[model samples]
Target: MVLDSLGKSLRGVLQKIARGSTVDEALLAEVVRDIQRALLQADVNVQLSLDLTKRVRTRATTEKPPAGASLRDFLIRIIYEEIRGILGKERPFDLKPKRILLAGLFGQGKTTTAGKLARYFQKKGVRVGLVAADVHRPAAVDQLEQLALKVGCEFYSNRAERRAEVIVQEALAHFPAHLAVIVDTAGRSGIDPDLIAELKRVRAVLQPDETLLVLDAAMGQTAGRSAQAFHEAVGLTGVILTKMDGSAKGGGALSAVSASGAPILFLGTGEHIDEFERFEPTRFVSRLLGMGDIQTLLERFDELSDKESAEKAAQNLMSGRFTLRDMRSQLASLGEMGPMSKLMSLFPGIGAAKVDQKTLDATQQRLRRFRSIMDSMTGEELDNPHVIKADRVHRIARGSGQKPQEVRGLLKHYESTKKAAHGLVSNRRLRRQLEKQFGNAEAPAD
Candidate 1:
């Protein structure tokens, strides 16, 4: 789900109608054409895609399937086998009390990813600490502090306007026992000597076990230049592509991995501290081929979804007690789980068509605005959006650092949620439908 449209054009043509030994040439040609289109649209290297297509085509015609195997099965099998071979094997990060330096463009979400990577390792029972080494004009230190809290990891920052290298030095001085340290650095608007020097300064002393180049998936080919610049300066061990939740063509993600000659280690899917997914070559290739990936869904749920909280949310909805406050809480939970699209895809048949591309993009924009407005509110106001009268809206808009219109939009979102909450309560069929769609194990049988 990182690049929602990456595999959108992929059409796996199932031409073999019945379970028959005989295969036709025209159908084979059509299926191969469809495969090529899908791979290209997925931002897969064109030559790689062409070569793969050739293999699949040649094998489809020349190699005969065993007696009982359907042509569909034969084709799927061949495609999977070839890709698995191409993807090769993966070597995960295995560092102990090791340092990992995160480098990327200013708005590429490097600081946030540093925190997420810490959380990922923390899950494995590793001690993790972060240094707010991003000493630039941006509020990078503050961002790291906030995300560090969300991950329950320690944060170190003098915020003394110290240079990036100095901050890393201080972090090393106070480095916790047996901990993984993530040193985040400020980024520039473009690839330049100054930016590279700042990162090189940090890289020179730390000599980290892994240096990840953070990039935005939406950056398109621009990501290529940034990756190349960083690699030339400090040599990236891997890459982390952020904002995978957006409608990025996935082209930039592909470009960074292929061109940078660095393995993709992690992906940032949302705004939350815990919103990340590790790279899995097999699953990714499967997705590129329009093959469903249920494993990713389950793994994400394990990391993000709290069963107890979900049960409580369900009971609240059934009892007609869900409010704007509940909506906010639920959204926070969803953010913790990676991309919104990925979460929606888990809802039975919703995966196939829950939200179209346009609506999904708009919803993400609206949600960001909504969250900003909510942040501006006091605890009481969040519980009672109705209390946000005109004057109060203006005050909150200023306090939250958002526009007055955004406050109103937040109210509208609350109104919509309130209506849906009550619907789940009064309508028995609606309750059943909701249960069937998102019910927890303990949900009442309405």
Candidate 2:
């Protein structure tokens, strides 16, 4: 709001000038000065911050305002574009795991990153193997060795010598049988002449498919210098900015990207290797510039459930044509919403924080019983559950392995959710976001 108010003030100033009133250069300079202060204070690089203000000043003076575009509108648009150009394209995490070479400062997370990337590929069904080439620093080998267990990948290490080249030769020979291989190399604080020379030797030996620089985003603007030094030393093909979730100065990673001219490939959001998110440039900039991540949510939903069936069921329910068959269809859809506790967590104010596991377990057991009881209905009986009187309930209980009381409870839960889904189908905007995330999941992506 404070920034928006400043934007409004500049808008008013430009509005006056576009209307043909004479404006002194002094006033225009003052406007650019205020804008510069706003951006720089937001943690933009001092030089880039200065260049942005200069571009706005030059354009405001040189170009005739487009018919009625307020000076503020013209200037804001220019600043937005220049900042984007500086931020550049989001580098994708596209390394297909033939072989990746990781290098970083000691304790800057290279081995852990290699393990995480390997495990990520493994989840995607790519066979993965790791070579812990970082032989210096006590148990850099053992540390990666222990961490490799949680990842379910093979880790190769040679403790006999600190020479990284010999490890690379062994890794290259072994990794070919696997779809992916991630190599971890030793790191030293500040550029160690010895370390870079050793990394270059390993790089020569393996000629890795990709070389990723692991940077700690926690270092703020200093990340830029660190990225530059690493790039000059061993050539950076891509960058992984770690620990952004804990940094408010997350924008500093942008500065590092701008400086090193390497695309950002992955973001380490949390401690676990699986906590990485593949960086998407457009969506990322959209979020940074205050647009929400609605598209990502849509993709996640589409990946989870069947779009066509969910839409049809929603349409049928809204037209007052709901049936017991529809309830069965919905059970399939609800299953797409993930485990019952996960479904509950999607409720506002619940996701991210942990929930009580005992309650979740009991609720899930009830769903299983509900599904079993529903299965006991005859085809025609399932289409219209009104036929399920006390006698039907007793028979279903006997057949489905649940008591009559449990059967009745499921009927009540079904009725409540049917009503809620009924109301939701009427709102087109809400329906779209819901459809993306809440339908049938395709047979788990092979």
Candidate 3:
């Protein structure tokens, strides 16, 4: 859900395309105008936004759908490609032994992004070391130290020495055995002489393999100037855009940074340590267009859950034996994945369906209450939900601090879900229909 406002607007445009009867000039013109407006309102560069819409229009008019592909799908594909083209392609990271330096201006979430980067590398099974080289800022050392502890990575800082270069030089020697070292360097209000001089000295001492500028997505079009300034300062290898989830103007930063030739390496999607994700242009655009990103969804599941537990859940679901405990487990897994709206955005055609935020929030709250109610249930009741009578329901509600009617609602929901799951598993014709609907029955045409 990065750039929520822009995403909603774009999704609305795509929904119009989906609901249209034909792809005529009028429809095409309306679609292009809507897209251009969405991009411009998101603070995208004016010329870039106009050029993108022009390309989309040109391609839509000239291109033909592949065999068995609908004109709607072809148009959707064209928009996806043009928007993705501005974001730039992802470069595969060479994750060997190397040092990385983080640089940015003051108040851009540079320190927090350093922690997120540490966690990202830690998940990749790299032994990371975090250095607190931001000597000018008060408590910056303590902040990075706490982050290193939270991520369970090595930490080093010379609180006694104020020189950033001296601190990083000592940090390199401190982390000799570690494969990946990430240095959290200093920042200033702007690209001043002193800041550049300090970063240059630190760079000379560290000579990091990757020098990334931590930028705020809310900076909008100004992000390009900032990126160019930093890139010239110490030769930034890439950029890390932070606060993407909270910013409505992220599209401006994204397209502008790409124009500056500093590819975005990662995105800080949310405020949590686990919310960071590597930037993939096609997958990102696919999500934006409501095409779904099943790969990322599957990867998130794998990262958050146990492999054996996932396999067991799949088996139970397919065998029509899904239990209340299994449902609770799956719900918990979804909670860990992120907000209900964000999760919904990953499903094919769901984004354009315009799932209401109020409804998603209500559903999320109800799930939490259901989980709480389930926690008060006995193992016997979880395995066999039918055993719980009125008396037991009252007792369970009292135990969980929920109303009796709420308890009954949970049971009702459980029964309905279980029944539908059984239908999907046992009804062969229904399964075949679903297979076709989900595009699993045949190979898709290019």
Ranking by TM-score: 3, 1, 2
Q: Per-residue lDDT for 264-299 in model 2, tens only?
A: 777787788787776655445433433232344444
The candidate that wins on TM-score is 3
| Candidate that beats the other on TM-score, 2 or 3, i.e. the better one | 3
Question: Candidates' lDDT values, in order?
Answer: 0.69, 0.67, 0.81
Model 1 C-alpha RMSD vs. true structure (Å) is 20.4
Candidate 1 lDDT, 219-314, residue by residue in tens = 755566667767777788888888878745465455435556667777788988778987766666555644443345445555544566655665
Leading candidate by lDDT = 3
Clash count, one per candidate: 0, 7, 0
TM-scores, all models, native as reference = 0.59, 0.56, 0.66
Cα RMSDs, all models: 20.4, 15.7, 13.1
For model 3, residues 1-446, the per-residue Cα lDDT tens digits are 77777877887777788668898899999999999999998999999999999999998898777544567766866676677779865666776668998999888888899899888888888888898999987599999988999999999998889999999888888785856888888878889999889888988999889999999999998999999988887898899999998888899999999989988989998888888988876557756755554445545655765656555665687787888888887777778778888888765446557689899889989998999999999999988887999999999999999999999999999878777765544443432332343332123424
- The positional error of residue 302 in candidate 2, measured at the CA in angstroms, is 17
The parts of candidate 2 lying over 4 Å away from their true place are: 1-42, 56-79, 293-446
Model 3, CA-based lDDT: 0.81
TM-score of predicted structure 2: 0.56
